[model samples]
Target: MTSAPALEQPVSTAESAEPELPTPVVAPESLSVKFNDVGRAFGGRTVLRNVTMTVNPGEVVAILGASGCGKSTLLRAVGGLDVGFTGELLIGDRAVSRYDERTAVGFQEPRLLPWRSIRRNIELGLPRDLEKSAGKARVDELLDLVGLSDRAHLRPREISGGMAQRASLARALARQPGVLLLDEPFGALDALTRLKMQDLLMDVHASTGTTVLLVTHDVNEAMQLADRILLLGCPDSDPAEGATVKSLVTVPGTRPRNRASQDLARLGSQLYAGLGVDSH
Candidate 1:
């Protein structure tokens, strides 16, 4: 099987060079994810239970919860990485088992190959069927989009962490997947870098109109990035019973939202309370 891109680098790059190509346009309704009564268990120990949610096409949804509340498990289920869950998980009209090319996942790490240049790493995510020349152009376009055009020839070890993560995002987009699954993709960055990445993500989302499913622990991150937030809470305070969707909070207003506004602060407070956190 072809290896998935590493977490430390972005996606893989093209093997040969070609002229630059225009960015591809993705159909707006190509990808929509839905979960129905989904549940998972290990050795009869439930991890997630009766969790149901829907991510509309072109929408950005954030999954927020305390650690070990199965946020990652839920994401994995959507990405087709974890198939042990029960009930239904669908990407568009087909089951996730159908493995549609319109979906891609990004992890916390860039996962770039050390030997490959930045450009090459991003190229790895391109469809294998793309023409060599077209692949090169696509890579160039992504590098520019991620603000790494000048650094394309550099190896992974040569760039900063923020740059690497940006490359990782580009790699995921390289496949031009309509649904982008991100699991704490900016969790490890410095505060400033993390905030910058968030803005960059918003820009990318606006341009591509890709549906996003983000799993994050940062309340502000969710408020800043997601149009809707899913709070998974532990019912009866029992792990064995598993965590389920506690609340779905919708953020009001337009893109480029003001994180410092009272509206977001109020929403953040609610999210924190749901997670059993005291912002006081």
Candidate 2:
């Protein structure tokens, strides 16, 4: 175990102390995600229903809502982490199955194994039958993508919180999943780290082109990261039916968008209102 480098520091191959390694051979790509009339219940109470939307390939879609309104429930359904729901979830045209390989999840916590080196933990994500050389190449690529290439040998307890989160993200990407599901991946970080994580995610998406489904309660985060924001809330007139898509808003700018743009503020205000929050 060793101390981690600053999370904000950029690690480039040109400045590394070690010999340059061959570029990883793993190519990045994405697929579409669709949920058709999906619904879920627990203890005889419905929490999500009638969730219908199609996420185009390589799009970043954010799910925003009040607590317990089923934002995460809907995301889990897509990743096949929770399957006791009604209707269908389609990942790249195939209905989702238990432990679907087409998708990978980056949970709120890093969930890294304490005993394994960061490199080995990422290796855990490779397909069981992937060729030995290919798996190594994929793990190498992921470590670099998440800025953990230099820290590859350290145990989980050795790194800063941000670094651990990066490792977790690399592990998720190691699968080369077409649809990446993120459940508040930055929710646990400090404000500055959260912002950095957001930027890192943006870069990852740009480089990998993986379609992303992110669930978060932060309105501003939704505004900053998503191509479109999906707001979920139970109809005020029909609370008994559980939460559903309340509105789908197309964000007004491009990737690495203007964080201070007034246009984003207007959309944020509207999303706040949708969640029954006072923007003022």
Candidate 3:
């Protein structure tokens, strides 16, 4: 395991007063995903307010918060599922509202069609214009990438929960999307399986360098997988009123992370403090 960077020095009140923050190291030229002081409201409820952030290429960001903090809603916005929010979201210079083939969402549920085998499920995520043979070949590769090659012929119901989830990941990666949105993708698995899945995801991300944003209630999970973590503060009834980013903590650990390293524990402590949770 590699050592983490030195702890960030605290900013003095005077230094903070100057404002004008520095740009992110990996700034996307046109902003792959930008939320410009966005606000979202539902009927009489406000889910998020004054939420601003930029997601660059080849990064994995995690949104962590309480149940009603609008984490899922934020993911929905970027996924192009909710259009009622007041904000601007761009994916590679194009607004998320506009159809773009460069993004895909993977939910907690495998949601694979029982009739379709693992290979076909992944193939479905590929573009229609891809030649059938080429698409099938790509699907085979993804299955192997996710460690599901041997289970390629199995139906969703036939595999273990972890295997099913791995297949779901393959489906998400099949499109070769620049952006991958995940909503609690590993929330349902056993603890050991969840850890294995996280390692698998890290491997996939390392190989593909896809921009990923995942929403989860687990602080440890967020700390383990994210390059940076953002907390969605508690929200009001409106989708866009009171919610805002409570804190943003960058993970300074080395690549191919060792789960037991003290660096991860330190990062996890900071993340927990940001969430107002007491770390054991």
Candidate 4:
């Protein structure tokens, strides 16, 4: 894993302050998320079963698992993007509604409109009720935060892949989401760009303090970004019961954790093991 610079220092108050989005010059509130015996099935086949876990306010939780283990399904359940699940899923004490306003989702694809300017695409996600002037300021703040201010006026096709993803992230932030759900947002990026995106995500998380639920296949990425790692899998390598929580690990240390730390390396090996990959 490539280590990002400035991973050993805490973000200062001024640097970490939330942007003028969400509320005019006010920071958005981070919300808690809960899954109570959540289970999802497509007809007769169960993909996720008994997924019960809580993501605390302002904390980042990363989900990892085998292929077809329902990682994306779990994330979509929280986003209210998929309604086929059983049991209760809540965000900030309210049962999740279809396309809940309290959350925003970022998929593996940037999904930006080809015709719209990057700024325009991001503006599309602003709350409908926000005043015109406030919305502009919010979008401006987001642009600066995501380092897309220079490319704000450019179309999605003009910028690099990383820049497009940043625009996507900014759009998601424009919703002022209390809970941000990401399904492998960086999985499509190349190795170096992905590392850079990981660092950028940490910076954004530090600044916004929004509760984040990230579904990723990379153990190192999880260790780098998540406060806790939530591993889902079918027990004993059997696929009959569906995937459920197999390990919930609390990563040690503070934000901007050292990527080269022995603690993290050891923990990474353990996580890979839990996923049925042996460290040679």
* Candidate closest to the true structure, highest TM-score: 4
Error of 3 at 49 (Å): 1.2
CA lDDT of 194 in candidate 4? Answer: 96
Q: What lDDT score belongs to each candidate, Candidate 1 first?
A: 0.86, 0.88, 0.78, 0.90
TM-score of each: 0.89, 0.89, 0.83, 0.90
Cα lDDT of model 2 by residue, 1-280, tens digit:
4866643334477667544443333344578988899999998899998889999998999999999899999988888898899998898888999988989999999999999999999998898889999888888878877888999999999999999999999988888889999999899999999999999888888767789999999988988899999999998888878999999999998988888999998998999999999999
List, residue by residue over 180-267, the lDDT tens digit for candidate 1: 9899999999999999999989888876888999999999999999999999978755757999999998998777998789999888
Residues 1-280, candidate 4: write the lDDT tens digits.
Answer: 6864742434346755555433222256889999999999998899999988899999999999988899999999999999999999989999999999999998889999999999999998898999999999999989988889999999999999999998999999998899999999999999999999998888788777889999999999999999999999998857788999999999988778899999999999999998989976
Q: Which candidate is the best by lDDT?
A: 4
In model 3, how large is the Cα lDDT of residue 78?
84
Better of 1 and 4 by TM-score: 4
Q: What is the lDDT of residue 220 in candidate 3?
A: 80
Candidate number that wins on lDDT, 2 or 3: 2
> What is the TM-score of candidate 1?
0.89
lDDT of 3 at 138: 78
Sorting all predicted structures by lDDT, with the top scorer first, yields 4, 2, 1, 3
Clashes of 1: 18
